[model samples]
Structures are given as C-alpha cells and as structure tokens.
Target chain A: MAGELALVADILSIISLIIGIFFLSLGMIGLLRLPDVYNRLHATTKVGTLGAFGVLLSIILQEGATPMGIKALTVALFILLTSPISGHMIARAAYRMGVKCCEGTCMDEYAGKRRK
Target chain B: MKRRLITYMALPVVWCLVSGYVTIGSLFLGLIFGMIVVEPFSKLYRLDEVVHPTGDWLAKIPKKIKYFYVLIKEIIKANIVVAKIVLSPTINIKPGIIAVPIRAKTNIGITGIANTITLTPGTLTVDISDDQSILYVHSIDATNPQGIRDSIRDDLEKYVLEAFE
Candidate 1:
C-alpha cells in the first residue's frame, strides 16, 4: 500500500511540476509582449506567483509532511501574500510617474486624480 | 492581557515553524525570545486596532473557509483565462483603469478585497482613493467597466465582508 502511495505521489509531483513550468514560461512571454507596466504586472503577479506556488506544492507533495514540506508550504503562502503587494506598488509608482496606458486601453477613471 | 498572552504563545510557535526546529530546548528559547520581543514593544503591537474584535469567532471560521475555497477556484480560473489571452495570436485586449467604490470599512477588509481582486481574473487593484471609499482597478478587459465593477461589488465583496469585516 505504501509503495502504491509513493508511486501515486511521484506521478502527481510530475504533473504539478509540468503545470508550474508551463505557467512560468507563459508569464515570461507575457512580461516581454505585454504593452505596459500594469499589464506586465498582471502577467507576473498572477501567472508567475501561481507558477511558483505550484512548484512549491509539488515539493510538498513529493516530500510528504516532513519539515521540508512544511517550509515549502510556508514559502508558498508568503508568495501568495507578498506577490500582489509588490505588483500594486509597481503599478502605483508607474501611475504616479505619469506612465501612459497602452493603445488598447479603453478608459481611465482615475486619470486626473492624485493621492492626497 | 489576552492579546499579550496570545501574542506571546503565537510568537514561539511561529519561531519554531520558521526555524524548522521543533525540539523542546528550541521552543523554550523561542519562548524567552518572544517575551523579550513582545514585552517592551507591546504598545507598538496594537492588533486590536488593525483587526476589529468581532464577536463569535467560531461562527466566522466556516465563512472564512468558504471564502478561501472560492478564492482558490477563482485563481485557477484566472490562470487559465490569462493563459488563453497570452497564447492567442492577435492579443485583442481592452485594458484600462476603473474606479470601484468599495463598502469594506476597515483596513483589513479593504486590503483583503484589493488583494483578492488582484489575484483573480483580469482585474488588478491599482490604488485606493484618498478618502478610502474607492479602489482604482486596472482591467485587461475594460470594454465592460460596469461588468467588472458589478462583479467586484456583488461576488468578491460579499465574501470579503463576511470573512474579514
């Protein structure tokens, strides 16, 4: 039974790793092709963060509930919390610096607004 | 008193979990360090102000769990949508910023909503209004700004209000 469980875990780990790498590569392509900082952030913050999270999850699954698994999970949780904040900071800075949105942009509700 | 005690206990467990050393001696050492850190700095750690002291904590746990479930599902859906957008040939996207008026009153609630919006499908929270009443959101698909605003107001904020607020 334990042997079968280990085989299942190994198969799951490979699948997770493939998914993680696929997203990570997509994020890289997005960062290169996206028109502006805000759009790039959409690529990195969501796609990149989830990719890293998937890789970490695979590690945990492969290692079971050991200390390494616990640490991987902790890092995954921290990545989820911190990645968006970094994206928010970059987007806010770019906006305040008067960086223009791309050509496809349809509207700007906070166009003339400045933080008080 | 209760807050201090909770902090004191939590800090050591955090220390052990972070350091990956779950032995007794390390825990005792962590306890000593927790006291040293939390004692003189008790005034700075005003968690009650940050997190409202809501009653019936037990009742909120189920709601919080459901919120997490929904969040994870949305994130997976978002990844697939973004992948499709990125993989498509022409890159037809209507991106822009829209001001979303928010109902979450507390800092935690507002932050939670913003982060949740950022993580989910094509929307990203850019900034908050000076009065804290609105969140400026950037959407990859801005052709229907009201759709984004209504979805945020209806779907996301409902779970946020229940869990965090």
Candidate 2:
C-alpha cells in the first residue's frame, strides 16, 4: 500500500511539474511579445506566480509532509504574498513615468486623477 | 488585550515554520522566546491598536475560507486565459487602465480587493486613488469597461467584503 501511494504521488508530481514548466514558458513568451509594461505584468504576476507555485507544490507532494516540504510550502506562500505587490509597484512606476499603452489600447480612467 | 495574545501565539507559529521544527521541545522553546520578545516588540512598534481585528473577525473564518477557495479557482482560470492569449496566432489584445470604484471601507478590504484583481484574470491593479475610493486597474482586455467592472464587483469584491470587512 505504501508503494502504491508513493507511485500515485510520483505521477501527480510529474503532472504538476509539466504544468508548471508550461506556464513558466508561456509567461516568458508573454514578457517578450506583449506591448507594454502593464500588459506584460498581467503575464508575469499571474502566470509566473502560479507557475512557481505549481513547481513548489510538486516538490511538497513528492517530499510529503516533512521539513523540506514545509519549507517549500513557506516559499510558495511568500511568492503568492509578494508577487502581486511587486507587480503593482512596477505598473504604478510605469504609469507615473508616462509610459503610454499600446496602439490597441482604448481607455484610461486614471488619466488626469491625482496621484496621491 | 486579545490582539496581544494573538500576536504572542503567532510568533511561536512563525518560529516553528521558519525553523522547520515542529517537535514539542522546539515549540516550547519557541513559546518561551515569543513570550520574552513579544512585549518589547509591541512596545517598540506600538502595535496595540494595529493588531486589533476590524470587525467580528472570529465569525468570518468560514467566509474567509470560502474566499480562499474562490481565489484559487480564479487563479487557475486566469492562467488558462493567459495561456490562450499568449499562444494565439494573432496578438490582438486591448489593454488599458480603468478606474474601478470600490465600496470596501476597511484598508484591509481595499488592499485585498486590489491584490485579488491583480492575481485574477487579465487585470493588474496599478494604483488606488487618494481618497481610496477608486482603484486603477490595468486590464489586458479592456474592450468593454463595464464588463470588467461588473465582473469584479459581482465576483471578487463581494467576496473580499464578506471576508475582510
């Protein structure tokens, strides 16, 4: 029974690893291809964060509820906590710098609003 | 009063995680260390008023759990949508910033909503207005501004309000 459980875990870990790498690569493609910083942030903050999280999740699954697994889980939690904040900071900086949106862009309700 | 106790309890929990030691001896040591340092830390930081829960926090646990589940589901959906956008043949995405008027009163609720918007689908929260009445969201697909506003209001902000406010 233990062997079977380990096999199931291995299978799930492999699947998770594949999905992680796929999302990571897609995020890279997005970073390269997207027009502006705001659009690119949509790629990195969401896809990239989830990709890293999935990879860490696979590590925990493979390692079980050991010390290493606990550490991996902590790292994942930190990533989730910090990734969006960093992305928000970058987007705010870009907007403040007057980085205009791509040609396909249409609206900006924050155009003339106070920056406070 | 209650806030200080919770912070004292949290110190040991954080210590256990960081040290990667969940043994009884480790936890006992952690508790001792927490008890010793918590008072000085609180005094230095003036955290008495800061750690207090905004409302009926204990009663919101079930709602908070539900919100967490929803957030996870939205994250997966976001990834799938982003993957499709990136993989498509023609890169035709209308990206722009739109002001999303918020109804969340608490600071924590507003921050939670902004963070949730950034983590979900194609939206990234650029900034909040001075009065905290508006959030500037950069959405990859801004063809229909009302659509984005409605979706966030109905799906995301309501959950944040329930959980945090």
Q: How many clashing pairs per prediction, in order?
A: 0, 0
lDDT of 2: 0.88
Extract clashing residue pairs from model 2. none
- Put down candidate 1 lDDT per residue, A52-73, tens digits, no spaces: 9789879988997777887887
* CAPRI verdict (incorrect, acceptable, medium, high) for model 1: medium
Q: Compared with the true structure, what per-residue lDDT tens digits does model 1 show for residues B36-107?
A: 877787678863344435677678999999999989888888899889988888788889999999999989
Share of real contacts kept by model 2?
0.85
Give stretches of model 1 more than 4 Å off: B22-26, B38-43, B46-52
Q: By summed lDDT, which 10 consecutive residues of candidate 2 chain B come out lowest?
A: B45-54
- For model 2, residues B36-83, the per-residue Cα lDDT tens digits are 877777767565764545468889999999999999999999999999
Return the lDDT, model 2, position B53: 51
Binned by DockQ into CAPRI classes (incorrect, acceptable, medium, high), candidate 2 is high
- The candidates' DockQ values read 0.79, 0.85
- Against the reference, the lDDT scores of all candidates come to 0.88, 0.88
